[model samples]
Target chain A: MEWDWAFVMQILPTLFEGVKITILATLLGSIVAAALGLVIAILRRSKYRLISMPTGFIAEFIRGTPLLVQLYFIFYVLPDMGITLAPLVAGVIGLGLHYGTYAAEVYRAGIENVARGQWEAAKACNLTAFQTWTRVILPQALPPMIPALANYFIAMFKETPLLSAITVLELMNQARSIANFNYRYIEPITLVGAFFLAISLISVIGLRWLERRYGRIG
Target chain B: MININRLGGAVSAAVLSSLLFAIPAKAEDTLEKLKEQGFARIAIANEPPFTAVNPDGTVSGAGPDVARAVFKKLGVNDVVASISEYGAMIPGLQAGRHDAVTAGLFMKPERCNAVAYSEPILCDAEAFLVKKGNPQGFKSYADIAKDSSATIGAPGGGTEERLSLEAGVPRDRVIVVPDGQSGLKMLQDGRIDVYSLPVLSINDLVKKANDPNIEVVAPVVGAPVYCDGAAFRKNDTALRDAFDKELAAMKQSGEFAKIIEPYGFSAEAAMSTTREKLCSASN
Candidate 1:
């Protein structure tokens, strides 16, 4: 079909609003994922099986299930149990919980990569458990994981479109709605692709810079 | 690997662009086409009483039934139907993906400009599915718009969505429910405050849902009645004319009422209206 620049101009404002929601969800979801992943990783390293085993299983369960199904359960199924959340909130939780599991694995690798002597050094320094973790282990374990964590966050951003399934007014949903209204899928869909490509390329550059900055870490 | 991905992307883009821009088939002896093929390809939506896809994969509902009979009279043996969304129906027909849209795709001025429509066939009024006792008392689209916190669930690109938007409900508040079942589910889950569809469609959904907690508010306040005809591509006037002639004859023979009445459509409502009048009527 012919490219309709006028139509593109008309749809830009609505699409930008959708873009804002998409970015907001990705940012919020990333924060939730990063924090929750660290918690799971630390808990899984505990000496008690009661803590470690269940933590591992729960992370695996979250990891194994599809995010779309999880979104449906959160948006459609949760209300039956009296746990209703707004569409965006339900979408954010689904994204965060699912990606948090993968983030947990990245944390595990980074923590494991730290030298065995680091723990011994912390003990010899007479540091308490909290100080040992906060001051010694994490500082060393964290930098190398930045690139990997950034990668997952970028991956999570791409997946933000899945939020539309739960009725979140995100970018993809906006494009579809516009397409349906105007009977023109080409323009709106092309605009969506362009927006996604621009964001993904910028983030890839950021990821490359991160890899360089943290390249020498253990 | 990056080079391969780039190449693959380019190839797929070419394929998609070709499909999107492909010329619509010329309507040379369009009626003869159906006679030779033994069936006409019609687009339908899966909203029962208007259009439905049976569990056995056969297509039924008032719109298709009327189209089937009309086509048969024109020496077309049967109609092959595919389900589509209301928004995509016209574009799909223009793209040559469907020969005619027999679904309850209502006639409006903008739509009439895009496609050639036969006389009106299935007519309906707007209805809302709400909590029992009409908790919010949403009698019209304006009422939903007035309640700042209320949201409506309607089929994407359907008349209900357009009407709600025209009535001043903001875009975010009008949730695009995919199908009848999902709309019902969303209403039950309190995801949307009101689920809007045509009167017969709401009735059909309510009957199947059999839920005591839900109720129907028909003849939505301030929404006008609408009618849908068999819509063909703009250049397919000869085919449209043939279909219209048979449709009018069917109406005269009392056959049109038989096909649509069982599905809860009022044939008189359709018979009393003309495509020109419905298409030109102000919304």
Candidate 2:
């Protein structure tokens, strides 16, 4: 009933403590996603059906199911199979694995967007496959990915709530617990939204700066 | 040598009687309406000691345990537990998301304005969960307030958060986790100094975690017990009354306590009166 500015002030500092966990999960999750995306992108381009076909299916399968279900599977079911991970570890892995499938498509699009003439030029220079990709194609292809990758970082920040399902007490979970105890969802939940908005606004501005920087590189 | 046909007819009749008596519905007018629809949808949060989603994806818990028995007695053959959050359970009922909530939703005055509750299925006191030795020596939220480093995990819209806040534990010190599992994990990992939750719910967490390091600090600060029960939309007064009648019968017969006690609850606890006089403001 009463909007206690002092109470909000008191709560804000504690939630700030959780920001480290939030940033850590998103940072670690994004790195895993980037690596996994690269692998899937390469697999999709492989000449062998054995490699490409199942890689595509696995990507589709991970994409098809809800991230929450995947999280539950990793946290609840995997332990029975003798695979165990801490809550945050399992959360980052599941979040990364799920989003990586989508990122693989982004990477695929970026790689494909590299002008066909560039590949021919690399060959004309007598460049090997690694040299051709590293020196010629990837340098051109990767810049466009910066915006999309930055976007994934933002998306991952929003998706941190899913980590709560796997028992990772990020910002939203903290808000929910506060709301539950106080019987006032309005304050704590509003604070969660405000916190999200604040972070997201900063991220969007930072990402725009990245996009512009990478746009010139393009 | 015997009349086999007669024996068969007599045996079938006895089985039918047993089944008929299992769930004694009001047979009041609405009973036919519910039966015509074919299923009684019960909302649940799927948390243990209250409602849980079984490994097979079926639902069970003290709340459902009592509800299921009452439904069986009411002749509601198909009782389904629909997943719903504790905060949303009342709204879900009001919006017709389900016929009723079988979760451990407390019957507070605020909730009473929106929904009617059946007799309390389980009465639980709020309590603090601490490390095995209780290294911080937490007797209540005062202990938490004394320590600047102390943090508590209280799920959203749960009573623990309220108690902690009321005790002057800063809003920041209380981590509003989404569920008991995370709260317990946070406590285990030392990310939280204490986890304040329903004694029963925390007990369920301790059992589920099966960790030796965590234990319940008896009778949480400020209150002895809170009454939690099945809630129905205020408009469903008839259904609420029917449920109450059957639940009262169950309690009187001692069947309610028998069914729920195994889930780390006391049948006597449920039977205890929830008179306001009994609920004290200070510990």
Candidate 3:
């Protein structure tokens, strides 16, 4: 019940190590999610049903399952199929895959928001399909998507705690270990909450700045 | 949107501030509360031989059996059981989630500081589950530490994890496997080099796993034999003392042995040590 400042100081380094892992996992997972989401959005919008239908089904399946169960399946169950991933790699992949499905919807909405006239204008400019997507469509579409992507990045940060179940030793896992070793819960748990709040608040401020800087479609 | 966000923050702040004054006022007598309720809620890890949940949905095993008998004598007619992890059991007791923990949670100095423990109810030695033929020839946690590639699996926050770390095994090499079952599976899958648990627990798991590739190494080197007591919150010292008295009487009457002996625990080992002796011993 008593908060021990000395104990807190002693454990801060260990917790900070965990914070580094948490941030690493979130950053890597966010990158994977963003790229994978674009792939999923592109495939789901394919002209052929043969490609788009299966892509849509796979995205929905990943979205439907719990992230924790998927992490377990990837970390523990995948070895049976002769695929073994290191814990951090497994955790990052799990988080990225799970959030990528949701991010795909955001990408789809961003792409759809581009006017039909923009596509026609690119065609009239004698641009190739790739040039049209890269120069005209995506440049306009990406700005509005920044805030939504930032929101998912923050969401992925919160979900990083679940990576502990697979033994990734992230921030919450570090706090639990400290609590278990010291038999003091209040301080470490409260510190974890504070850490999460501070990071989220910072991310929100950054998101607002991005929105103000790039939100205008024109 | 800003107003809603402000309101949500304000409400959460108010709630968090209110929790500062909301500590559950402990009743003067915990035993009296248990007696009035007619059932004592005890936490148990579903590790076989120490604590197990039967196929019939009943709780059994040496720990619960000893605890149930002691509580029954104290006029608590029933002992309801909640299956929890070894690390969470103590916090569960402190959080008022359980009346007692009889999950063979060993009485180490750090744990002794957390909860009031009754006299010893079960005594066990450390053991490791390794691949058959003991390919790595790992005899102790030190052996695992010496081998750079070896990964040892132990329950998170349990005594075995502490032992491995104390023996110089790096934190990364000591994989915190979730439970007994998962530890065995991890061993089978070659996910970890060794799975550490109590001797009886390893025996039980290896038997159930029925895998010829698995072998048990008992009395792990540099690890001491430890005993566990039914742990109660520090405020429940009166109830714990009463429970200890009843446990001593049961030991003397041969009733304690009759209950725990069937589960592969030595009643003599449990009776030999006092809680004070075990609690003061730093692991």
Candidate 4:
């Protein structure tokens, strides 16, 4: 099939607009995932089974279900219950909740890797529990978690296409829209692939940089 | 600490396996693949009456029913359907996501540019669902455009949407939705003045909505003439040709009419016109 440069150029602005939505969703979703993951990791380590068990189960449940269903439930089902969210809001929340479960496992591993002696020493030095966690455990734990989080950031970028199901109009959705309206697939869809690959490659390089920088932190 | 190490290895292994299994099958000799697999991966529009997913996840519809019988006669047993929107069906087939599409999608020339479509399976007419009693007196697209308050709900990339746009309906006035469900929902919620689509599909949507306030705007303008056809990727010339042959045979054998009549379709009107004339003349 012949590539149409003019058509590709015409749809570029719209596709780029879609890319902006995707980037925003990924960034916002990552923030929610990181915060919720840290909370789940902390709760899982709590002394009380009441706190830890349910938290662990919640994380596992979210992890077990498909992201597509979760997205549908959030976007469609929630409106029936009198909770209406903008498509983009629903997308970010669904993405965040789904990935947060995975990140919790990462956080739990990182936190547990801190030597037991560090906690013992912190307590002996009259450090508060908050101080012990913030200064001692987290500082050591966060470095290892950074690379995994960066990987998740990359995964989320790729998954942004699925947001199209809810009419959020991301890059893939825009490609479909362009092709549908113009009756041409060679240009718009090809541009979507190129755009996704370019962003993914850049993210991979940035992730490698982060891994190196964080690995050297310890 | 012990659990930490174990979890890391398990997670890495799972991720690796997911990546390994993610490779999709390449479409080389698609007919052979279908013959070997015993099912053609068909793209379907997830619209009721035309096509809907059962509670058990099996697909059934007038379009799928006719297509299935035709394929069965061709010695294909399994008809695996990938649910997609009307606009996405063609691209999905071309992308190798599905071998063919039986979405009751109309045979239009612009679409013919992208994919090879089989003979007409059924003819569906364009119509709309408006607020009860036709509050705006918007019987047609022209009527809707004449009034400032009338917002027409157009399913994005579908035939009605393209037609509405061509009929001089302003883009700002045309509220484009992603699917039939959303379009119906928008009309039910009173967000749009008219939900435009084919008549049989509209009947299905109306039954599903079950709201007395919403009614079908009868005698839809712009000629009640359309033929739904099976769509295949342009590259699959052999498969499309075989399908056309089987389709013509089904039409002559009266199996096509038997399949469509049960789904609230006028099979006679759908099949009276042939593809050769329709394809050449339709915009």
Candidate 5:
């Protein structure tokens, strides 16, 4: 079918609502990934093998599996065990848990990039372990990791369409619904492509800005 | 972002070329092509009675059985079936992904306008698969819409979803369940208050599940009984008409009744309605 511009205009408002949910899922998922990754990284680095081994395996497991299957487990399987989450909550959890493992790797690299001398110097200064991590190592480690972590979040943003599997009304889902109803894919699907391209372009610019702000290792 | 730019460029190029090729196309050759190809591609929903896939991976059920017989009569050797969601069938036909959709994708004015539909094939009324008691007392789409907390699930892009929307349920409230089994799971999980589909499809799922916790409410209030036809691409009217001719003869010869009745579809219901009447009926 020919591209119907009018149909595009008509469906934009509905699609924009979907875009809002997509952005919300991405933003919330990014926050979860950032926090959870730090916890996993710290746990995996623990002196006790009991904690570290399981933590490492879990992270590996989460990273090793497909996000879509994980989403189905969270959305469908978990409910049978009496833990029912709303569609958005389950989607965000899936997105965060899957990406958090990758983020943990980034965390490990960033922390390792902090030289041993810095830790020894913090110990010599009589600073506590918390102080060493917070004041010295983190300040040094975090800046360079921003670009890598931001890259994951942007990647996560593109993958948000998978949320539709569990019935999150994200952009791709909304576009499909519109196309299904109208029996016209040319406009709705093309609009979805346009929306995704525009958003990714904008996010890439933001990533560049983030890189400029926190990119330097020194 | 560069990839996005490439995607945008590629989409535009594809759309432009399609437009260029839209006219001066070859004429009435789809049937000829299918006959030569040995099999007509047909879309089925995998929802039983209407359409189903067997354990051996062969396709059967009333819709495909009828379509297969019609194609065999049309001199095509076999019908190749693909399981598709109801919503994708029309677009799939348009995209040349399938020759015709034998899925119980009900005929509506919008769908009638979109595809070349053969005379109506399978007919059924809407039904809800709700909690054992149907505690919310939902007998109709309007009932679910009126209850603000109530959520209903239907197969994505299916007629039940459209009916729910038309009945004034908010978009967020009408969950697009992926399939019959999932819909039943969602119902048991209490993720959705009601799951809707054709009456027979729901019965088939409930019977398979043997779940006492669920019940079916058939002939949903104010929702008229609807029928589905094998949908061909808009430009494939010649193929549709040829298929229709075979189908009409089968109906006249009692073959159609024998093929469909064992699957629990009422042959008279389908035979009594005309596409013009269903398509022009006020929604």
Candidate 6:
């Protein structure tokens, strides 16, 4: 199919609006995922089985299911239960919660990678539990986890297209609407691919910088 | 490892060669190809009264009924139906995925540029499915746009969505619902303020839903009554012309009315306009 420069120019503004929402969803979702993952990782480490066992099971359940189905349930079914969420809110929550489970595993591994001597050393310094975690343990744990967490952030950005199924008016949805209206699939679909590639490439470059800066655990 | 790689290369080569051989040879005539195959694949949407799949998996609706009758007259013995969304049908036809689209896809100037269409077969006016008593006071697409908080659901890639956009409804407010059933469900659950479809299709859905809270507003203000025709790939004009000739004869002999009348469509309305007029008309 031939590319139409005029058609591409006409749709650029509308598509740019969608791109703003796409990036917004990813940024907000990444924040939620990073925060929720820490909470889940900390809770799962609890000595009480009442807290840790159920938390482990729930995280596994969410991780086991497809993200698209989860999105549908939140956007369509949750309203029936009187828990209606605005489209963007539902989309971000779905993305955050789904990726948060996977991120939790990374956090758990990072925390576990801290040598047992580090905790014992904190105790030798007469540090309280909070001081041990906040001062000695987490600073050492968090740096190495940055590369993996950045990878999931990139993945979550790619998965933002699935939000279109719930009518979030994201980039892919906007492209499909333009394609449907004009009866031309080539230009819009190609433009979406180009946009994704450009963003992902930039994210990769950023991820490499993060890895170089934070990869050393010492 | 080298042996395994060699085996993989050989297997892929065989598969690629077989795929090349599987391509169908071009037929000199479209009708000849259909007659030899004995069944023509037609695309339909599962929108009731217009096109639908029966419980036993048989396809029957006003659009397909008229299409089947006309194809039979043209010597195609059977019509096999595949349910598809309105937006995908034309591209499917162009890709040779289906022989024709009988999915009540309305004829528009943009669409006319893509495929050859037979004479108009099903005609209908726009309608909205709203909550009882019309809480939003939404009588039309323009009204939906006026209320910034309102969301309207319409089938993806259909005329209603286009009408809503043309009426100045923001892209975010016009939700592309998957089907008539989900549209009804969305309206019932307050996910969308209004569900848009043709009059007959809305009646069928609201009846099937049996929900007292929903009501239909027909002839949505400022939208024209749209007519649909069986669409074929642009290269299949000979087959389309033949089908149109038989369709015109059926309309003349009152046979067309008999087939579509039971489905609650007015044959006179369909016959009142020509494809030329609809295709060339300015919105």
DockQ of each: 0.65, 0.16, 0.55, 0.24, 0.68, 0.55
* Model 4 CA lDDT for position B267: 70
DockQ of candidate 5 (2 decimals): 0.68
Deviation in Å, model 1, residue A105 alpha carbon: 1.8
Please list all clashing residue pairs in model 3, or write none if there are none.
Answer: none
Model 6 agreement with the true structure over B1-283: per-residue lDDT tens digits: 3799889999999999988875443535788889888888999999999998999999999999998999899889999999987777887788788999998899999899999999999999999999999888888899999999999999888999988998999988999888888788788888899999999999999889998998889889888889999999888889898999999999999999999999889899999999999999899
Q: Which sections of candidate 2 miss by over 4 Å?
A: A1-66, A69-109, A112-139, A143-160, A166-218, B1-32, B52-59, B71-78, B170-173, B176-186, B204-210, B261-264, B275-283
Which candidate achieves the best TM-score against the true structure? 5
TM-score of each: 0.88, 0.67, 0.91, 0.74, 0.92, 0.91
C-alpha lDDT of residue A61 in model 1: 87
Pairing residues by index, what is the TM-score of model 3?
Answer: 0.91
Worst 10 residues of 3 chain B by lDDT: B19-28
Which residue ranges in model 1 land beyond 4 Å of their true spot? Answer: A43-61, A117-131, A216-218, B1-27, B30-39, B75-78
Mind giving the per-residue lDDT tens digits that candidate 2 earns over A1-218?
A: 46878778777765665666788899999999999988999899999999999999999999999988899888767766767686799999998998899889888888888889998888999999999988888889889888887788689878888886655767766665545444455677788788789989998899889888876222
Candidates by TM-score, descending order:
5, 6, 3, 1, 4, 2
lDDT of each: 0.91, 0.76, 0.90, 0.80, 0.90, 0.91
TM-score of chain B of each: 0.91, 0.80, 0.90, 0.90, 0.90, 0.92
Judging by DockQ against the true structure, name the best candidate. Answer: 5
lDDT (tens digit, per residue) of candidate 3 on A77-180: 89889888888999999999988988898889888889999999999999999999999999989888888888888999999999989888888888888777
* CAPRI tier for the interface of model 2: incorrect
Which of 1 and 2 is the better model by lDDT? Answer: 1
**Residue ranges of candidate 3 with Cα displaced over 4 Å:** A124-126, A216-218, B1-27, B55-57
Against the true structure, candidate 4 has what lDDT?
0.80
Worst 10 residues of 6 chain B by lDDT: B21-30
